[model samples]
Target: MLQMPDFLTLGHVTRDLHSDGSFSLGGTVTFAALTAYHLGLAAAIVSRADQQLIPELSRYLPNIELQIQPSPQSTTFANQYREGFRTQYLHARAESLEISDVPVQWREAPIVLLGPLAQELSPDIVSLFPRRPGTILAATPQGWLRRWDADGRVWPTPWMEAERILPQIDVLILSHDDLLPFADGNRRDADAILHRWSMHVPLLVATDGRHGATLFRHGQTQRFPAYPIDEVDPTGAGDVFAAAFLTHLHKHGDPEQAIDFANCTASFSVEQPGIAGIPTTEKVLQRMNEKKNLTT
Candidate 1:
């Protein structure tokens, strides 16, 4: 019998194309599962991808268990970064994930991250996990808020199912870029939007790259600063932060410490390209202590 994983993430494993004809395996599941694993959790993934990706994924996530739903093509993205902003183009998409794709035994996983890329997961999928204490259901809703044109240029769309999904999740994590369509690039408007969602969700986090993250809970809000670092690639930092936060929160139940640990962990992710920069628990704590000593 297979033992249940401590962390489980459902999404589509993506192929991220770079300039000069290079590509790497990426997606919320890729980064999040790795973060959980590095933090010493038994992480597993339920994702859709082409069979060819299996070898590459196995190389990156050697110890993590993967339940892949075979697809004709893997979801692909080409990202252009200019002056700290990113413009993404969608090239191809894999199959969508249904609740049935999840393994029956994995439903009771203590930490669940619903990370849909390209809106390939239905909102109803949240019902798979029971809503109760000790089980954390967290989501990064960027995929649901996205819509692409015939030309493959990706843009943000309103998350119409927020009302149904917000109340069901224990935590919600999204980037400032994810709020652009609704907030019109204003931070205040973005905070207002987060405030509205916070009323339904127990914990809400909006991460601003470099500027750090803000937490909304218990009718109050707090901002946590990012660990300063020169970034090489910012591709999966938010996903890393989300996974690290969820894992730490599950173990310690302290939102502030979780955010601090998440910020440190995500800072390491950006120092290298793709998943190469994800740090071990030892490195994360070393940096955290370094930051603490510098402040003191």
Candidate 2:
């Protein structure tokens, strides 16, 4: 068995298609894991990967190990834009990954980030992460709110098992729009919303598009303004943010620094298209130092 890396992110693996006909490999775990690897962390991706795609993905990223569940085919997705909104369609059913697929050695990883896409990261997956010392859990709730119709149409569906999963999360990241439907419009202020959510978990974060993000922890809250950028595509920016945030925590253990690092990292992601736009840590730091907000 391969030794467990320091950080492991679990989620779906998909090929993304933008409206411009640009196609690239995507999904939160894919981009997030890569960001962690680039930011000086030992990173691995536990995904639902098929035999066919695994061989190819391995070739592109040989250094990054994949703890993939055996599937008949990889999960395939195509997204298009209507105005600034996005519409998604699922092209294939990926093999659902189970706790049994997790390697014994992987439990040694100090941090585990759950990057759910589709319905891949279910209650079963939440229960699988070892609840022990030195291991932290982070989750993005987008995966829980997604649903597909018989016609293959995809959209946000209101179903959050967060209350059940809260104890497992050391940090929970999500956008205001992602959970608004499930939040029942009862949340008036963003901070208030976070407070309500954190009643179950100590650390909760609610992200707002272009307005930056807010973090609530132990009765304290920290807010960061989203860096201004001409958005070429906002596709994987959230995942990029999560990846950088978690990487900083793994290395520095300071929430403030982690949020700033993540803000800079995500600022760099939206200036390009899909995964092709993901900038290196040096590139992000350079732009941050230069303070040049280049819009693509």
lDDT of 1 by residue, 1-296 (tens): 56799999999899889798878888999999999999999999999888788667888788999888788999999988899677899999998997888999999999999998899999889989868889899999999999999989998899999979989999999997688669888878888888888999999988999999999995589999999999898889999999999999999999999999999999999999889999999999999999899989
Name the best candidate (by lDDT): 1
Our model 1 lands, by Cα RMSD against the true structure, at 1.3
Give the runs in model 2 whose Cα sits over 4 Å from its true position. 18-22, 183-193, 218-220, 290-296
What's the lDDT for residue 197 in model 2? 70
lDDT of 2: 0.77
Model 1 TM-score on a 0 to 1 scale: 0.97
lDDT of 2 at 159: 56
Q: Model 2, residue 196: what's the lDDT?
A: 67
Task: Please give, for residues 70-98, the per-residue lDDT of candidate 2 as tens digits.
Answer: 78877778866689666778877687778
